[model samples]
Every structure is written in C-alpha cells, then in structure tokens.
Target: MIKTASKRYINNFKGFSREIWILAIVTLINRAGTMVLPFLSKYLKEDLHFSLGEVGWIMVSFGCGSMLGSWLGGKLADKVGFYKIMIFSLFTSGLMFFGLQYITSFWGLCFGMFAIMTVADMFRPAMFVSVGAYATPETRTRAMTLIRLAVNLGFGLGPAVGGLIIMAIGYKGLFWVDGATCITAIVIFWIMVKEKTKSPYIDKKHPDEILTHSVLHDKPFWIFLFTCFATAMIFFQLFTTLPLYHHDQFGLTEFQTGLFMTTNGVMIFFLEMPLVSVFERKNVHKVKIILAGSILMAVAFFVLMLDFWIGSLIISLLLLTVGEMFAFPFSNAFAIGRAPKGHEGRYMALYTMSFSLAHITSSKIGMEIIDRFGYRANWLFMGILGIIAALAALYLYNFLHREPKKT
Candidate 1:
C-alpha cells in the first residue's frame, strides 16, 4: 500500500506534463521573490524613513500597476504566446527589483514599485492561460490545486528564509536575492517550456475572433467576478489587519508573526489537494464550501477580539487556513469552469484583477478604520465583510446552478 501510494503520487506529478511543471517552478520562484513585500512597509518606515501614509500609498501604486498589467496580460497572452510574455515579464521585473536600491525620493520609489508590480502581474494571466491549455477538463482543478500548493509552499519558505537574509545583510540584500532568483526562473522557463499551440481564443484563419470574446458581456461571469472581489477583500486583509492586530493587541514578535503567516501556507501545502479530491467525488456543493470558508475566516477574525492569548491565535490560524483551503481553489476552478470556451485567458485575468482591486480597497479601508477606531474595529469590520462575501458566493452559485433559457 505504501509503495502503491508513492507510485500514485509520482505519477500525478508527472501527469501534470512538463509544461505544467515548468510553470509551477516559475510560480514558486516568482513567489519566493515577493517575500520582500511582507516586510516592505517596515523596511520603508525604519530603514528608509518613510511615513506610514507614504508607505501605504506606495503599496497602492503597486496594486494599481498590478491591476493594469493583469488587464493587459490577457490580451497579450492571446496575441503573443504565454511563454514569451511570461519570460519577458519575469526578466523585466527582476531588473526592476534591483533598480529599487537606486531610488532616492518617494516618487521614485513609487515608480519602482509600480514598475515591479506591473511586471509581476504580467505573470498571472499568462500562467492561468497556460494551465488551461495544459490540462484537460477532468484534471484541470487538480492541476490548479497542485499549482496553488506550490505557491503556498514557496510562500511558507520565502519569508522565513528572507528574514534570515535580512538579518544578515539588510533590505538591499533582500532585493539582490530576489533579483537573482527571478533571473534564474526566467532562464529555466525559457529553456524548459515551449508554447505548443495557439490560445483557443485566437484562431489562425479568423483573427477577428479575438475581438469578439469579451468577458464583460457574460452576466454569470460578472456575478462570479463580484464574488471574487468580495472574498478577496477579506483575504487581503489577512496580511494587513490580522498582523497589525496581533502586534498591537497581543504584542507578538516578528518571529511569532511570521509563524502566524506561515501557518496558512502550511495548511495549504498539506490539505489542499486531498480536500480538492474529496470534494471532487462528493455531492457537495461548491458554493457551500466557499460560504463555509468565508464564515470560518470571519469567525477566525472575530475570535481575535478575545483577550490576548497564544492558544486563541493558533486556533484562529487553523480556522483561517481551513477557510482558505475551501475558498481559493474552488473559486479558481469555478471561474475557469464557467468561462466562455476559448476565453480562459480573459476570464482568469479578470478573476486575478479581483485580488488587486481588493488589496487597494482593503488597504485604504483598513488604514482609515485602524487610524480612527483601532485594530479591533478594523478586524471586526473585515469579519462582517467576509460574511457578506459568503452570502454573495451563495447567491452566485444558485444563480449559476439554475437552468439556462431555451434558445
């Protein structure tokens, strides 16, 4: 039984195909590079002597650039190939990372952030489009689940490793390390992955098909997109409000905080694929999973309001991880499943935009609430919003599950 299980696991990874593995490796490396961001605000405030609001604005700039890049990446993926676009984005973003060390003024730093985010966002739609191209419908969700697992694993290791790097050499060392990783990822992708076929959205004879596949006209797609936006708002707040609450209310050290963040990724690494497979076989409704995730996430935040206790925080992390395991993969699967055939690039791009939009909006809202009412109020508000997101997911699922009108 042990040998059989090990064989099955090996086959599953091999079955993802070489292209999928390449993309997964690239994702892991790129995510590892982004480890700088979690500590970026602190780096700016202490090492660079920037104000809190200025730091927030710099983050907003990055978010805006990412949104714009994702919007454009879809079109580029359809027009050019995903591999080419991704390689270019990775290399350019690497250069931008190293360039940050040279920027002196606040505006220059903002521009650097914007440029880096734009290049980073370029990877999202291209990667999603490649996933769609690589996997059959039967394996698509599982493939994406594996990819998410890779991302989380990278997330788990990147910051912890980055923390050590920062302690040894400072923020400049962080940028240099990320840049080197990005360059290595680019070379690996260029050598190992080849674009095998044109995007389904783009026809060789009928070039006009590209112009016609607009996702905006699909009502059901828009419903799913809105749900994505709502959930993402709650999700992004985890990085911002959750950590601040832990620090201000509970007084956790940076190491303790890192552990709190790492717990989410660890859960994803262990539980994501098994959960996906279990749900794949059951008669369980996808929307219910999403709702359950939202409720658990909200409950986790609400639990934080309890008096400072290490046990509570650990429990809360477990709850949040459960919520993430349910919501994120299912949401990605549902979006790709519902997309109009041949428009996966466009659909996934819009789906990814929800995250960028959520980050921008949540940061602003969180900052305002944190400034006025305090961390508890901010977390409570996010928890309430998460519940609303749950309702939205239910509404969307029912709407999609309904019968279509006869032509």
Candidate 2:
C-alpha cells in the first residue's frame, strides 16, 4: 500500500519534458529573489515618508502599468515568441529595481514603480505561453503545477530571507538582492532553455487547439475574469493591507510580517502539487475546484474578523494558503484550456490582468476602508466579499459548463 502511494506521488513529477523543468528552475530563482512587493507598502510609508493616501495613488499607478504591460506582453508573445519576451522582461526589470531603490520624490517614485510593474508583469503571460508550448495536453496541468510549485518554493525563501536582509542591511539590501536574483534567473534561462518550435499536444485523441474566441465576446471567460478580479481584490489585501495590519495592530516588526508571509509560501510549496495530484483529477470540474478555493478564502478573513491576535493571524494565513493552492492552479488551467492554439498568451494576459486590476484598486480601496473604518471593519468587509464572490463564481461555473462530466 505504501509503495503504491509512493509510486503515484512520484509519478506526479514525471512525464514532463525537459524544457518545463528549465522553466521551473528559472521561475524558482526569479521568485526566490522577489523582495520588493512584500515590502513596498512599508517602504512607502516609513522609508519614503509617504502618506497612506499617497501609497494608494502610487499603487494605482503600478496597477495601470501592470495592466498595460500584461496586455502588451500577451499580444507581443503571440507575435514575437515567449522566450525573447521573458529574457527582456527579467533582465530589464532587475536593472530598473536598482534605480527604484534610490528614488525619493513622489512623482519620481511613482513613475519608477510603474515602470517596474510594467516590465515585471510581462514575464507572467510569456511564462504561461511557454508552459503551454512545452508540455503535452496530458501533462500540461501537472506542468503548470510543477512551475507553480517552483514559484511557491522560491516565494518561501524570498520573504523570510528578505526579512533577515532587512535586519542585516536594510531596505536597500532588498532591492540589490532582488536585482541579483532576477539577473541570475535570466542567465539560467538564456543559457539552458531553448524555444520549442511547436507544442507537444497535437494528437488525434485530444486536440489542443480550440475555436479562437474574442476576449470581450466570450461570456464564460468574462465571467471568470470578473471572478478573478473580485477574489484578487480581497486576496491582494495580503500584500497591501495585511502587512500594515500586522504592524499597526500587533506591533510586529518587518521580520515578523515577512515571517508571516513565509508561512504562505511554505504551505503552497508542500501542499499544492500533492493536492492537485490527488484531487484535481482529469475529470474534476475546474469550476468546482475554483469555488472550493474561493470559500476557503472567505474563511480565512472570517477567522481574522473573529479575532485579532497571533493565533488568529496564523490560522488566517493557513486558510489563505490553502485557498490559493486550490484557486490559482485550477483557475490558470481553466483559462489555458479555453484558449485557441496560438493565442494562449492573449487569453492568459487577460486572465492575469484580473489580478493587476485588483492591484489598481485593492490598495487604494483597502487603504481607504481601513482609514475610514477600523481594521476589524476592513476584515469584515473582506470576509463578506470573499463569500459573495465565491458564490457568484459557483453560479457562473454551473452556468458555463452545463455538462456535469466535462472537464
């Protein structure tokens, strides 16, 4: 029995092409070196001496850049190819962050943040395209999960180390380290990874191609996009407001908040692939999977609403982790599943823009809510939004896929 279980588990990592692993490695290095977003809120308020309102506006600028960049990346990836896009994004974005560290003026800093987000976000759509290009349809979801696993693994390291770096050196150290890691990842990808001329999933039994659908006209996708936007609006508070909550409410230091973020990365790293392997089977309804994740997200903030302390915070983090594990991979797979053969980048770009949309509003909206109401009020609102969004998603899922047994 033990051997059978072990075999199935090990097989989860098998069947992927070599190129997918290379992508995973690059993703790992890039994510591991990520230092800025987690600390950006703190840096703005404390280091730059910006008011919370200013922070909201700056994040909105970042959001606008991210939105445009994502759209551009997707459109360009179809025309130019994913490899070149990624290479340019990683190397250039890394260089830009170093300059970001030195900027002190409000307009200057806003412009710098906008530029960084624009460049950095291009990598996402390109990576998704690369994932689809490299893996067979049979193995594609697992391939996606494998890369996600790598990302989370790096995320696990980045923030914890970031906290320590903040202590050892300071915020400046974070930017330098972030730049170095991005460059390192770019080098690995450039050296080892090559562009696959074609996708591996062309076969009689399961054709990978789909009818090309317009993003605006596709009803299902639009529904999914709205769902993504809503969930991210609440979920992104982790980056924008939750860190501030940890500091202002509990009086936790930067290290402590970073340490809290580490739990998020750790849980996803250990649980995501395994859960996908065991439960996210070929026939499982992606909508059902997404709805389940959304509910857990609600529970996360609900836990926080009930109490505000170390224990509640830990529980909330765990719930949010599990929610992400469920939501992100499946949601991504669904988007990829819907795309036409050559336009995966565009479809994913639109999907990814959902989060970027949240970035535009989540910060400003959250900061406003917290500033006007109390932290508990903000938590309650988040919790309520979570439930409503998930329920709406559930309804949309059933509406979109009328057939029960369909993937």
In model 2, which runs have C-alpha deviations exceeding 4 angstroms?
1-9, 41-55, 163-173, 202-209, 243-260, 308-315, 402-407
For model 2, the local distance difference test gives 0.82
- TM-scores of the models, in the given order? 0.88, 0.86
- Candidate 2 local lDDT, 1-407, one digit each (tens): 99987776687788888889989998998998997777888989998899988987887788788998898888888888888989999999999878888899899888988888889989999898888888877677778899888877887778779989999999999999999889899999889887764465633245334443476676667777877887888888888799998888788997898778777766776577778876646567777888888888888988887554678998989888888888888888878777766777888899889988877788778888899997888888888887887887887777765633233
Best by lDDT: 2
lDDT per residue for candidate 1 within 1-407, as digits (tens), equals: 99986675555444566777777887888787677877788888999999988987888888888998897776687777677777888888888788887786899988888888887788888788788777765566778888887787787778878999989998888888888888888888888877655444323342123222468777656766776787678777777777776777778887788777777776677677777777866846666787788888888778877756667788777888888888888878766655554676678789899878987898678878989988778778978887888787777667655635200
Candidate 1 Cα outliers beyond 4 Å, as residue runs:
1-14, 199-213, 283-285, 308-311, 403-407
Poorest 10 consecutive residues of model 1 by lDDT? Answer: 203-212
Task: Please give the RMSD to the true structure for each candidate, in Å.
Answer: 4.0, 3.3
The ten-residue window of minimal lDDT in model 2 covers 202-211
C-alpha-based local distance difference test score of model 1: 0.76
User: Each model's C-alpha lDDT?
Assistant: 0.76, 0.82
